[model samples]
Target: MTFPKRFSNLPEYAFPRLRRLLDCHGPGGAPLRMSIGEPQHAFPPWVAGIIAEHAQEFGKYPPNDGTPELLSAISDWIARRYRVIVEPDSRISVLNGTREGLFNAALALCPEEKAGHRPVVLTPNPFYQVYSVAALAVAADPVYVPATAETGFLPDYGALAPDLLDRVAIAYLCSPSNPQGAVADKGYWADLLRLAEKHDFQVFADECYSEVYRDDPPAGALEVADEIGADPERVLVFHSLSKRSNLPGLRSGFCAGGPQSMSRIRQLRAYAGAPMPLPLQRVAEKVWADEAHVEENRRLYRRKYEIADEILGDVPGYRPPEAGFFLWLPVEDGEAAALETWRMTGVRVLPGAYLSREVAGENPGKGYIRVAMVAPEQELRHGLTRLRGCLFG
Candidate 1:
């Protein structure tokens, strides 16, 4: 039997590698998990009720694109949040989660060749792992662009050489980025949109953490594109109920783009995608329609932000995150910091290098640790204090 060569060079998924690295050592104190970004905040009280109301619908096959009501709810939320109008029926596809949408959009939209060459897919260095895998799945060249502090933690696609840009089929961007927690500003979005237009590429905007910011909502790529009159198909935005509604287990999200791009995505989804179960879709519908719970969720994260700032402030090289839940804390060495922190304090965190790929000789995330601020308030504070004492002291 022959295995696919595309994934042959890929490293083990982050969690498995982490387990191998830390599971052998006994935790020095009571275990406190600050590793994964699974939200510990309570979801809306009404979610269960809505799911129960539609429980019987689980027996029926869900609509591949989305139920009209669910689609309308998502559209309305987009209108309210980004002030961009997306046609519910034609321009949106409900996803099992944003992960699915993010991966499959590349398959659906990226061309086999661009400008008479094998296409390129651009991903931020410390990105959601799916982006590179998706590019490889399509046999496109996966270009890992550095999103380090020097670049404001957002990939500067515009800075690439024209030859590279011309071969780009898609560029994956995560605002309120996963490991770094950096939010791309409106100007950044506009510049990227213009670059995409000039180069003839699509922008896949992973905006899952859009709702978890500390101050004003993070500017979205779709909104910025709309403002600048960029081609509607130029940007595809993925959003989720996972972070916004504290419903990771629900696995509900949506992708919105232009009609042609969405049609292609929907066509692929109809053949290969697993639609959200109807009951879960009902929950997502209501979740998207309601913002009060999301606001409360943000409030909890805001408090955590304060706690993080208070605890880690005195530590040298601690740069506070502008948005998102993770703190990408600078360290002498990510793997060493992670192991030492776990051995000394039992507060588990992911090594930043696990989230990034080595480009040339350097992995941008090699000198940091990504600490999730997703634990409960008290536990999170305790973990941060112990982490500070262990790693920075």
Candidate 2:
């Protein structure tokens, strides 16, 4: 059977495509994988103990929204991190992971049409792939706006024609943006929220990488929305323990917004959602309440940041990521850089093109490679040094 036409043009996923590009060539030295953004830093040691304590509850069905305690913990965390207060019962949906929430948001929210024509879903060109897929899944027009060095590594949705803005039904934004690692300041968020209001679209703020920064925390969409008195329904913020807690396998995350939007999303989820396991939910409750561990995680990333800067700081076109763990390194050609680095130095990294889409014959990621700063300190230093010599020297 022919697959849906909407999905016909979807590019191959990043990791698998990387394998295809590099697996055929044998490593020239000992292998060091810094390709995908999988965290190698230690999660809290207590995480496992908590899971063991609640292992018995795995058999029981989980709360569809969230346990009262878990919700309270999430609310407390948000209030602390973003200074945005939200009522759990009415505005939060405990997600299995942010990916589930991100993808399902489009399904639950995107309407059949906008402004009397096909609706548009805006995303950063070199974005988390889920955003485009979500738009396509809902039959909305996926608009890839470039988030390049020229745009402060954030998509300039405001530059789109006013007519196009009016047709936008949803806009997906990632702060501490993937690959680029640029954080959107409060001012940027306020402008976007205002644009959303004027254009009549929803904002999906993916702040999953918010906790992986060095200094001042990134300004959150909901935080700015509240400060500016934007409609609560206009923005939905998704956060997760994956990057923050380095518990990617735990698959725990959440979505928070206005009660009305939460109601519609929760309704869709009740029919098609994988609620977090009751035991996992209990673990999340404790995880969310703790700040010590989160701080430690941040400290580790901070060190890596220094290491990266010291190594590549002087390289031409080397833009130090403002936040997040990935390094978006510049090169003449991303694919060539990745392949040669793997073959000569045995350091594996992802080509930037994999994360972007070409519009008007220009793929924003074509001249870069994405390296994950998730390896151990010494190993990361060696790997990056090798990469530097192989790709740049």
The models' CA-based lDDT, in order, is 0.92, 0.93
Kindly list the per-residue Cα lDDT of model 1 for residues 1-393, writing each as its tens digit. 999999899889999999999999999889888889999899999888988898899899988888899999999999999899999999899998899999999999989899899999999999999999999999999999999989989888888999999999999999989888898999999999999999999999999999999888899988999999999999999999999999999999999999999999999998999877999888887889998998899999999999999999988888888899999999989999999988988989999999999989999999999999999899898899999888877
TM agreement with the true structure for every prediction: 0.99, 0.99
lDDT string, candidate 2, 1-393, tens digits? 877898988889999999999999999899999998888888888888888898999888888888999999999999998888999899999998899999998999999999999999999989999999999999999999999999999999999999999999999999989989999999999999999999999999999999888789899999999999999999999999998998899889999998989999999999999888988888899899988988998998999999999999999999888899999998999999899999998999999999999999999999999999999999999998998888777
Superposed model 2: Cα runs more than 4 Å off: none
lDDT of 1: 0.92
Worst 10 residues of 1 by lDDT: 276-285
- In candidate 1, residue 125 scores what lDDT? 95
Deviation in Å, model 2, residue 116 alpha carbon: 0.3
Spell out the clash pairs found in candidate 1.
Answer: none
